[model samples]
Target: MMWTKCLCLLWALSALCAPVNKQRQRMLLISFDGFRWDYDRDVDTPNLDQMAMDGVKAQYITPPYLTITSPTHFTLLTGLYVENHGVIHNMWFNTTTTEKKPYYQTLFVNEWWDNGSLPIWITAQRQGLKAGSLHFPGTSSSYQGEVAMVREVEPILYNYKNETAWRENSDKVMGWFRDQDLDFVSMYFGEPDGTGHRYGPDSPERQEMVKQVDRTVGYIRHLAETHGLTNSLNIIVTADHGMSNVYRNGLVEEITLSAIPGFSFRDIAFHLVDFGPSGMLLPKPGKLETVYSALKGAHPHLHVYKKEDMPEHLHFAKNDRILPIILWADPGYVINGYFPVQFHKGEHGFDNQEMDMKPFFRAAGPAFRKNLEVGPFESVNIYPLMCHILGIEPEVNDGHLNATRNMLVTSTGTRGENRSILQNTLTGIAAVAGFLAVVFVVVTSRQILKRKRKDKRSGSVQHLPEEENTKQTGF
Candidate 1:
């Protein structure tokens, strides 16, 4: 009985300690800015192809509307729409301070980056796990007053001149995973995006950049294999958004805000323009109707909307950061006051529903299923999936685990099911132990009572025999 009780105690202790003894699951999220879904079809990416065959690949990952870098990337991290997260655009006017901050300038301000919803890294850190980021958006700012354990001190710069930067960053990330033992790590690459902008998406330069990016992937894979972490490490390669080619050779008419009648730049208190494919105007004081009417049908390729009347599907209307009037350009058109002498050959920041705006998503690791092709899912869904793989509870956000659950092996038998099974098994063992303990006590008590009765009866018989002998002798 004692042995049985001791065994039960040991089993309970082991069960309690199991999570602490198990190896921690590691995740690495990599983003290639402006990497379109079809870029792989354009270039040779054997490493990515093998990863897809070995793991899971999305048909396409749809980012939120106004598909720009900061907003979509932040959405992926936080699992919230732009309106909910408060990063309404890549560059928006901050009404609180009445200052206009562009994308690059917004990186330094906490107000622009720190939205209410916690990002995956911040959430992981809050749950006592370590996280690291290499130039990922939102890593630069503190979330709910907590920052990641490790992140780049300065904003990551795109060194087009230095081709070796990607490999170096990969090595740094691998070090964080293998040595620092970070639970989650995110890395960003500014490639193909830059190349696409400099020379259109279909240009040879963009294709070469794609190949170069693929080589970087191969480098990271080789490092993972060398460290015996290929199976243990979950690596996700995705992009913020995709790129679209813009017509800049006068093949298509240029649309500019300045061309609109009564739409003088002086009438705007603060505005966001000159950036391609979209524009936001905050009319000075009461020029709202005048500005809106002037820019409504100003160009054949442009579409204008009042902030409240913006498409509900875009989820971009409710935020205060969104200006009084929003502008969208067609796929091949660029929206600016004047065509620059040096304009980007390609651009983004259009309606996300367009196929050209879809980004690529591929993941490989122990947690993900093999060779699966799924999705046309919202990019926001990635947050919950990431939380599931890392074994952390996700925050309240716009994503659902069921959307991407099919991509994971454990999802076949749901996590709750596995947990219930474990609980049932442990409960059965405990119940059996308790039953044996009760039986041991009952049987032990019965044996003690029986022995005492036998001793008492034997003494009475011995005494009787002694008494009979004395009486017969009659001394």
Candidate 2:
């Protein structure tokens, strides 16, 4: 019971020191969903360009396999690959019941997100830091029975292309930082992805959305600066995956699984297709080999493999949630199970190795070096970098800090952040100790003065014994 009180005291102490930790440097991770690395290439983005000028920029960052939103964003949050994190797709499903939920509804499924890994929000909060998630994917779910101190989810049928709303979210998050004193935040923008899906990635609509995203970036910085966070905030802007133009109008070969002669949905117990270029199938008992044989070499654009024989580079087949048969198509084509139901001009979920599926990364703030563009790195490595910036020990993750270490300022090195944490903690402790000492001296002096006044009233005054610069405990 004594140990429990001690533990509680330590937790309270850490919470009381959050203001000091804020001075150590707060971290904000922003995700521009499906913002392709090259989207900014053709568009004139002065804000993004200025950000690159002031801080670190990467040529590109690779998302994990199954290059979709939820799984890839989960990778950013947990530093685990899609297979490891177990959020295999945007939608949650049960093969037995054939039940499924859309992306937004799936956000509330705690079991889906809390499989075995913890997002940085949970880890940060557990370590005595306050964190918030602003409409970020997986924000609605809790991990290990604990949720972020603060979080917001986008409303149903929320508009994803409103520049004004984007700025509002930016201002709101900055307010959380300044007023609520949050240590870390993960903010999300459902931009360019929606525009890219509505109009092809190369279309003018998508280009316009990129311009809006850049302006939003500038607005966020303006808020950060206005809130007096310029000296104490580290901001990382990245995305889940990139966008690609879908091949259509009958100009190119299409991959329709239902059209295959031997391939039959009747042969499969559960299947996921038409979501994008990727599809997964769990054949009925004893039908795995038959399904594999039927789908293999069925279409030149579609690549099918048994879960066990999936390529070693793609760490997607290990999880039990993954279906027995995996299928994906080349960049231009998308796989459809029953005719071409999808009509989006743009698509993702292609091979991560494909250039079109790669996302961009940019970071700025006191902790990051200026005007630096780093080489290519995987998005998985970002989790460790954020942990380093927040001075919190990261949970077991597949990411490595060395991948992004070169981007940090010399003063914000690995040791530098840890030292800052220790220094802030010691500073808090010292301030508390000094305050207690002052209280002790003041209380003691007050009692003595009261006794002296009473003695004077009685015509006798006694003095306190003077310590020779040492106390009972030898100073």
Candidate 3:
């Protein structure tokens, strides 16, 4: 009885230790570049509106520091913030080189490339899954040993050149699905955003581009479904930042950080140049109040915040990368290019609440429950969500799975509980291994019995041959 019990225990342990058959799940993430939240609600986006109605939508999505393309894009892929991931800015001004390299230029550099720590693609690949990216920022060269299809920004994306490029881009993305099973595919569209910046957000030209983008989205959906992806392919549409029209009238105030006494600025908002719009100011000892007072006097429309006073939701204070002073721009204002003279029609990278700076998120897929609005979410949360859906582990994400849990299909029941899923998976694995062990023992016993039977037959034939030898002598 003791032996039986021991054997049973061995079986259970073996079952638990059995290898699991890995599954290949696929995901498709699409960034409509500059598609604003307002466009889905206001413009003719029948397909996109249906997507929102049938999918999960997040009310607000916050960008990581500087709220620029490279940093935010890296965050989505790696699940780390700008400070942690180290992309830092859209266009990094290297003081050492004294030459500016667009973020894409650093794609091949080992420091930033492999240092991402836990990029979504690398994580997926580690698990034996496949991923592909098309024309998204920060993916131009490769990272974590994955190369994505990426293109540099061109002046031509601003106007008529945009339509041709966009069509070509969409076609290329659609072609990727042919004969290939991928775990993830990411594509970016830069026209509507580029148009919004050049032609103003509310302009007729921008509105038309919005319509064009809608058509492109419809085609993408069609291609996804026709390829039998159906709802299995998760589609996430989001933006790096929102846009606000910066008028010449708004530039009445202008002041450089150097002009202020005992205050230093590594970077300042261009719109609030005179008063230093939405910025971080490191003040010399005993000069905080003086700098704050002078800033307020110089720019009354701006809202100033101490590091401790920043919004509780931004998660800003504890990290040193965030400068001591945070600046907020008044609605419809953004800072732009270098000193003195300049009038610009477009800008982003401002405080989260600026009318033109709010980002929206909409996601739909087999993993997502139909017709759900997801959050009041930050962009940081996106990294983890991507990892979860792809079945990859994330290493450096500040965001948690709970942040966007509502979008998941199993989010409500026992499956919705992550702990339950893990527990059940382990249980199933153990059961399978135990069953296999018992079958192995049975097969081995049968083979041994068959061998013994064959040996007995041969022994009987040998004894008969000895009798035949005697008969030959008698005959």
Candidate 4:
């Protein structure tokens, strides 16, 4: 009876002292921007290839829209489409306003902060875990909850001339990774993306670019292994969208952002000058059909959707911020203005079976079941999958929860079924937990402030926000 009593006491003490859910493991999500699963004849990503051989490789991972950087990267982290996440295109749209928007009105930090999308890092932070992004899009500004973000300076890939800059920045990210004891780290590579933009998808130059990125990835992998972090690490390698060859001669007509009556241009994304990209059209009072018909008549090759007519699968609607018409350039064509823009071996962005289909996913780590081949999941599903591994809960994200059966081992551990439920539960729990944690931090901080104020009353100097350093004694 004494032994039993002692054991019970010890168990209770252990429960009180033990870390919160130490079963949670570490995760590393890396994106090789614009990287296609079939970049090389051999898909010469030896390290990545090995990861697939050892784990799971998704062949066709569709991106949200235009496959642009910001929205696509957002989808990767949040598992929502451009329509659902609100980062519809590379630019931001204000469907709320009735005033005519200027030709170049991009949403800055303040507006982006108000977006409804909840990045996974916010979920991780609430669960009392560390999260960091090396150069993921949407990190430059603040996100809800806690996250360590290195803002993206140049959001788009201009040309191959920026290759050196990309490498330098990537190395800096590696340095950051080395310096931190992070449980989750996201490192993004923009080489393939840049090469894809410049020389087109099938360019030998693009192939070479992937090789260069492969070297960097190899170095990162070596770093993980040498530091004994690989055992607990689950590496998720993916891309925003695939590249296509665009021939400048194929364009029919050019319409500048200035040409559109109410449309405004924000980001410098090349795809913005399409049949009519992601923004709302008010149609000058009752001229809605007239305006729509004129635009449609002008660009027959373009596909347009009334916000209400958008496919249910898209999970989009005629929201205030949504552009009335979404454009898809006819296959083998770009808009007219970019006609003289030199592009080799073009790729299409329309709903064509090929261009819309992005690369696959490859995950290797203890959290994943080995030798799994998930056919093709919507880009949005990545959010739940990520939430599952991190042991963080997320809301019922835009995409459905896909089972990772291929990656699971044959243990009767109930982990397989738990993944879906776990993601749903974790999302809600993390959200609530994060809010509570922030509240706790704020209250504690306030209490500390009151104590400091009391101390100051006894003639002690207290350091406050941006106040003079009176606490220092003339040092």
TM-score to native of every candidate shown: 0.84, 0.84, 0.71, 0.70
Shift in Å, residue 172, candidate 1 = 0.9
Query: Model 4, 1-475: lDDT tens per residue?
Result: 5445545655564444433322335777877777775774544778667777777887677776645666678877887666667765555544334333221233244355347767777767766667777666666556654345433434443343355665566555545545665677777765677667667777777777777776766666676676666667677888777766554443445333345454323222222343222333444445555555555645555566666777665555634556555555555555433323434344434451454346657787777776767787677777777776665777657766544444544431223335654566566555555655666677779889998888778874444632455445444
Steric collisions counted per model? 0, 0, 15, 19
Is 2 or 4 the stronger prediction by TM-score?
A: 2
lDDT of 4 at 374: 71
lDDT for residue 119 in candidate 3, whole number 0-100:
63
Supply the global lDDT for candidate 3: 0.63
Give per-residue lDDT, candidate 4, residue 234.
71
Instruction: Please say which candidate is ahead in lDDT: 3 or 4.
Output: 3
Over 117-152, each residue of candidate 3 has an lDDT whose tens digit, in order, gives: 556766666666666676666555456566543333
Count of clashing pairs, candidate 4: 19
Error of 2 at 296 (Å): 0.8
Residue ranges of candidate 1 with Cα displaced over 4 Å: 1-23, 95-98, 153-161, 338-342, 411-475
Provide the lDDT at 56 for model 2. 93
lDDT per residue (tens digit) for residues 1-475 in model 1: 6656766775775576332223346789999998999999978899899889989999999898779888898888888888888877766466546677666667768877785778899888877789999888777888778888999843445474245777778888898888998889988877778888889899998898888878888889899988778767889999988999998676988887777777888888777778888878788888999888888877889999999998888999887677888899989888886445438889998898889999999998888889999967989899988887786778888889889989988543323344555777677777766866777788789889998898787866666678689999997
